[model samples]
Target: MHVGVDVGGTKVLAVELTGAGADVAVARSAQVPMPGRTAADAEVEAAVARAVADVADGRPLAGVGVSAAGLVDREGRRVRFAAHLPWRDAPVRDRLAERIGVPVVLDNDANCAARAELDAGALRGVDFALLITVGTGIGGAVVVDGHVVRGANGMAGEFGHVQVVPDGLPCECGLRGCWEQYCSGRALERVTRVALGSHLDGPEVAALARAGDPVALEAFATVGTWLGVGAAGLVSALDPERVVIGGGVSAVGDLLLEPARRALGGALQGTSHRDLPTLVPTRFGPEAGAVGAALLAAAGD
Candidate 1:
């Protein structure tokens, strides 16, 4: 069996797979507390090692694959940097391999999620598609001809950092006008707070918008427009055949997509000449990451 680990800021999910990623044997998970004094890297590594040990249970393992959140290096081994987690020029793959006593492969979480979508989720059968995840922050993965495009620095599809508005809202990445500041789940909450003078979660805001609340509707529209603008930049750069928008906020359905579609049409460089890629919500929902990690693990065998 092969072990796949999806290490997030708060939790680590581990799964055991067989039969070329089709059959599942056992699954387990563990949480890593926020590091108090020590670096979060050690805590996360410990959590992943524990999770893998629990799932392994003495069975000879094929290999290990890790789906991490960060800007992975060109070799897909080191994590150059991550905004939420504390990893700087970290040799994650080598460290994990040394600790677990097995060969380990690592990739960006967005890329892993996109690979899973291509193998078993929404983008199945599509040759070229862009997986745009709108969660606490925005992330993107570019798949061309069934292979991920890890750019020179392995951060090519980092659409979240794209500047949508010059001198706009401040981002945690130390940027002033990042796309995630306007087009992510946190962005939705920020807009709702500004427009309604109250904090509302993504689901609540969507419900209010569906009930015809003007403020909620306007917030969604604003986010949708920003999403389109950012997506327009991606389309211009990659020219992907399809754009898959996934993450927590995508549950708003057409409430967000309609405005994004309109904005994408309006912002395209040559609107009439090029075929606009279909913009749709993700079919995998929240499970894309785990499923993708499992697929990566299976592929390692």
Candidate 2:
């Protein structure tokens, strides 16, 4: 079985994939909380190894794929940087391979998600598209001519760090007013806290929003609005045929997307002349990253 791991901001998720081609499916999965950002790179890699082992459950050998939430080098050998994690020019792929005792492939988590969508989920036959994942922070991938673009520095889709606000909010990447500061899980939590005058995590805020809490509902609106505004800029630049939204925050569905759609329609450039790109939630949701990673490993990508 091929094991794929998604190393996110708060957890390490592992999925065991079985079968081939269109028959591929996740047979089992496991997760472990991510070590704190202050932890050493070895500790974080160990957490990923543990999750992979838990999901494999002592099964026979197969290659492993890692969907890392960072700037994975174009060669997929090193994690150049990760704002929320401790990896900094770390040789993560080699280290994880050594620990797991298997051939390993690594890539940016958002790129992995885009690969999954292109392979089997949403972007199957599409020629160009943009994928934005709204988890702890934003992650993104660009598709052009049916291929994901890696850019000159292998960091083309690091859109989360885009300065949307002028010195607005501080980011872990040491930037101010990044798009993620206004449109991610962390942003949702911050907005909800400000509205309700207390702290609450992403899931808690979603729960309250589902139950029609005014503060929670408003928080989604706020974040969703920012999401659209930022996406408008990207659409203007890339002009992708479709814009897919994924990640943990997208699980709330229309509670978040509806607001985003409205804002995109209003804020987008050339509204009267250009055809607006469709903004939809991810078909595979939060699992897209891991699924894509497995596909990469299976195909030796």
Candidate 3:
């Protein structure tokens, strides 16, 4: 059995697969709360290990793959840093392998989601594709020839850090005017909070937007415009054939995408000649990270 784990900010999600094929189905699935922000690094690692053990259920494991919510080495062995979790330059892959008794691999959560889309979800048949996952921040991946473009320092897919504004809002990455600060889930929450003196959570914001509340509609449009602006820049740079808008915020559907499509056309490098890039929603939705992580573990590379 192959196991995949998604190490998220607040929860660890794990899935087990047996006899994988087109007919593959999850044999077991589990979710455990991760160590809180104040927890130590060792405690965070232990939580992940416990989640993996529960999913494995003492069966002979084929391999274990983890999609971690932080920057990781290209070899998928080390986690450089995670803002939500208390890990910094740690050998997470090695620890998980030691505790689970299986060959373990690790990758960025965004990369894992994009890999799942590349293999079985969006960008399936496309030669060139760019994935932008808008969660707490933006997570990006560039795909060419079925392989992720891991930069020299394993930081190639951090599209959120790209500067879109010269002197804009400050970001967690110690930068100003980052694309993610304007386009991600946190951005939406921030926008919503600003719209009303009181605060509304992510679900409440989405609910209001879906119900056609004017304030919610305007907020989504504001973020969608920024999403398109960033996509336009990416289109000019990479010229990918397809672009995928995903992560938790994608549930807004056309509310987010339609404005993006409209804004992207005029911002293209050569508006008249180049074909407008195709933008689509993720096929795997929220499950992409776990599914892709599992596949990577099964591949054992």
Candidate 4:
């Protein structure tokens, strides 16, 4: 069996997979709390290792793949930094390998999810695809020529940090008016709270949208506009065959997508010409990261 681990800001998720190619089976899965942002590197690695152990179930492992929410080096062995989690230049692969006694591969969480989509989910036969992960912030990945574009610094797909407003909301990356600040889960929460004067979280807002709450619907429309605005830039630059929106906020679906579609049409450079890419939802859901990580590890072998 091959193991995949997704280490997030608040939790660690691990999955065990058996089989090959598109026929892979999910054997088991586990989740654990991640270390605090102030946590030491050892603490973070230990939490990830514990999650892997919980899911392995004593099966002979091929290798462990880790999907991390942060910048990773070109080699995909080190996590350069993670804003929400405490990791900086951390040798995650080597340390985790030492603990598990197997090979470990690490990559940006969005890259893993994108790989999952390309190999077994949304972008299956597409030659060029863009995946935008909408969560606390946006993370992105591109599949070009059947391979994830890692870029020169392995930071090519940071779609969130792309500036949208010159002097807009402050971002976690110390920038002002980043695309994620206005388009992600955090943006949803902020807009809901400020506009409705209610303290509803993301899921609560989603529920409200389902219930047809006018305020919630409007908030989604606003955020969706920003999402589309940024997406237009990506579409212009990459021109992927499709764009898949994943991560937690994707649950809101067309509440955001309809607006995104409208805005994307307006924002595109040449609105009247060119075939726009298909913008769709992800089929893999939250487990995409872990599943894709394991797939990547298995492929390397």
Name the top lDDT candidate: 2
What are the per-model numbers of colliding residue pairs? 0, 0, 0, 0
Candidate 4 weakest lDDT stretch, 10 residues: 17-26
Error of 4 at 186 (Å): 1.3
RMSD of each: 2.9, 1.8, 1.7, 1.4
**Most TM-score-accurate candidate:** 4
Q: Which candidate order results from sorting by lDDT in descending order?
A: 2, 4, 3, 1
**Colliding residue pairs in candidate 1:** none
**How high is the lDDT of residue 292 in model 2?**
91
The clash number for model 2 is 0
At residue 60, candidate 4 shows an lDDT of 78
lDDT of 4 by residue, 1-301 (tens): 6789988888999998766656665778999898789988889888888888888767677789999999999998789999988888988889899988989988999999988888778888888989999988899998888788999999989999999899988987898989999998889999999997878889999999989999999989999998888999999898888999999998878998899989988998776778888889987778889988988888873
Q: Cα deviation in Å at residue 95, candidate 4?
A: 0.8
Candidates in order have lDDT scores of 0.80, 0.89, 0.84, 0.88
lDDT of 3 by residue, 1-301 (tens): 7888888888988887655444444567888998876788778778777877898787777788899888898777799988888778989988878877778989988888887787777777788889888877888888877678888878777889899999999998888999999998888888988988778877788899999999888888988899999999988888889999888888888998988898888688677877888989987677778877998888877
Clashing pairs in 3: none
Please, what are the lDDT tens digits per residue for candidate 2 over residues 1-301? 7888998878898898766655666788899999977899999999988988898787775899999988989899999988778999999999999998999999999999999888877788888899999988888999999999998878988889899999799987788999999999999998877777899999999999999998899999999999999998999899998999998898999999899989988987678999888888887788888989888887887
Model 4 root-mean-square deviation: 1.4
Estimated TM-score per prediction? 0.87, 0.93, 0.94, 0.96
| Model 3, residue 34: C-alpha shift (Å) | 1.4
Quick one: ranking by TM-score, best first?
4, 3, 2, 1
Evaluate residue 208 in candidate 2 and report its C-alpha lDDT on the 0 to 100 scale. 92
**Per-residue lDDT of candidate 1, residues 78-100 (tens digit):** 99888777878999999998988
